[model samples]
Target: MKKFAEIDSINIKKNPFVVGSAVNPNKPEYTIYLLIKDDYLFIVDCGYFTNKRTKVSKWLTYQLEMPKAGLPWIVNTIENKFFKLSHEGGLPKDVYHYAEVVDGEKLMIDRPMFLGTRENPEPGYEIHTNSRKEGRTPKSLNFTDSFLFEHGLFDLFKDVAQKIESGEFS
Candidate 1:
């Protein structure tokens, strides 16, 4: 049972779009924001220090619609940017837990048997170096899985603007 990095602070605010936030307990100065903007879902991973503040450590934008093969197309547009940021060397590496607020209820999806777990996971692909550990392991990182899980909810609201534009749904 490895000890994974826990989410120290988390705040979520909802409006026409949902903004979900998670702070790394291992690194208090670092945070990740998952937002739904228009037809796309974005993951903005940022880091800041006393001397210098980073603009955007990592930014990933994924299309809301599913592919023809019935798969979510989540892509990390910003590549290797997070590596340059200052941290304990293992940033997202320590953060592997995930949670979501649905219908005004906060749901915990951190278990390994959940939808976004190793045994029964979500539909998509991820590029991670470490294997999924039983508990929160420093070497076990699941940032990609966490993003995809949140994106699943974001996808539900993505077509609203488009449908409104076409006057199909009001």
Candidate 2:
């Protein structure tokens, strides 16, 4: 089996290639790869996994306590929801709704996740990003910057799907 980095070129056609790197469970780096298979094309973002954006992430950030507890929670949340599609299905307009807090209490308890840095954070995670609401929904359009707020979260499910598909992922 070849290490993913050396794979070089994807046999798929038209699809964007996906690349990812991780050592720490929290902060995994991701990128997109364009691959074309049999005359068709697709784009795969690097941060395709739910638990971490890259491979062997949890192993790298082996805090023994925090990373273990936090990884599962974050991964589970993304897998449960989020939507993604190609230029064909068209990116869902409601994609941003993902960051919406479905369960306030349970969600809040896991605030200090190891993935996103919170220590001495210049722009602390607590402050909501007013984004991702672009063409989001009537419920969010009223907010001044809601469209941009959820932009980061909009890809929750999308990444997982891309990661799972051997046609795109492997």
Candidate 3:
């Protein structure tokens, strides 16, 4: 892989359109906001600010994004990003341990949901919860695609895509 000398050299566009959003069922404290800019799709984590709701100040706070590629590409990018973050001491040691064993590329992406694994035999997606105290271990929660969809994730993405086609998002 080639490395860019500067972040701006990547040529990312600004003012990404907010497409959709969904709150995690297993962990309601965090919400996933969908955004898009040309060739990029952003699955952002907007942490809780108010009771059972998220504040705009928290949008894109997690800084997670990927090219509008296939499912394999998305999963692989997510795993690779976390792997790099772990090495940089940005994530907990336990997450790195899980990341080592869970190969995102190998996970089944036929289902539309976040993908990952915990200590269990079955593969699933992982979400990290922030601890109020500094230096506390972030809690990792795992859930399936069906679970997320049951809680409105599927509808969120679908509605946004429809809106975009109708020029409602522009």
Q: List model 2 lDDT by residue over 1-170, tens digit each.
A: 11122223223223243232122223344333333333222223233234535433321110011111222333444334322343434235544333433222112111222223455222112112122122552211111111113433324324433444434432
Angstrom error of the Cα, residue 8, model 1: value is: 23
Quick one: ranking by TM-score, best first? Answer: 3, 1, 2
Q: Candidate 3: minimum summed lDDT over ten consecutive residues — where? A: 1-10
- Model 1: weakest 10-residue lDDT segment is 65-74
Instruction: Look at candidate 3 and give me any clashing residue pairs.
Output: 116-124
Q: Tens digit of lDDT per residue, candidate 3, span 29-145?
A: 666666666654455655544433543432223533333332224344344543356566444554432222122212122221434333323334554322211257443334466
Give the local distance difference test score of model 2: 0.28
| Model 3 residue 71 lDDT score | 24
Q: Backbone clashes in each candidate structure, one number apiece? A: 2, 34, 1
What are the runs in model 2 whose C-alpha is more than 4 Å off? 6-77, 81-112, 118-149, 153-170
TM-score against native, each model: 0.26, 0.21, 0.39
Q: Give the TM-score of candidate 2.
A: 0.21
Which predicted model would earn the best TM-score? Answer: 3
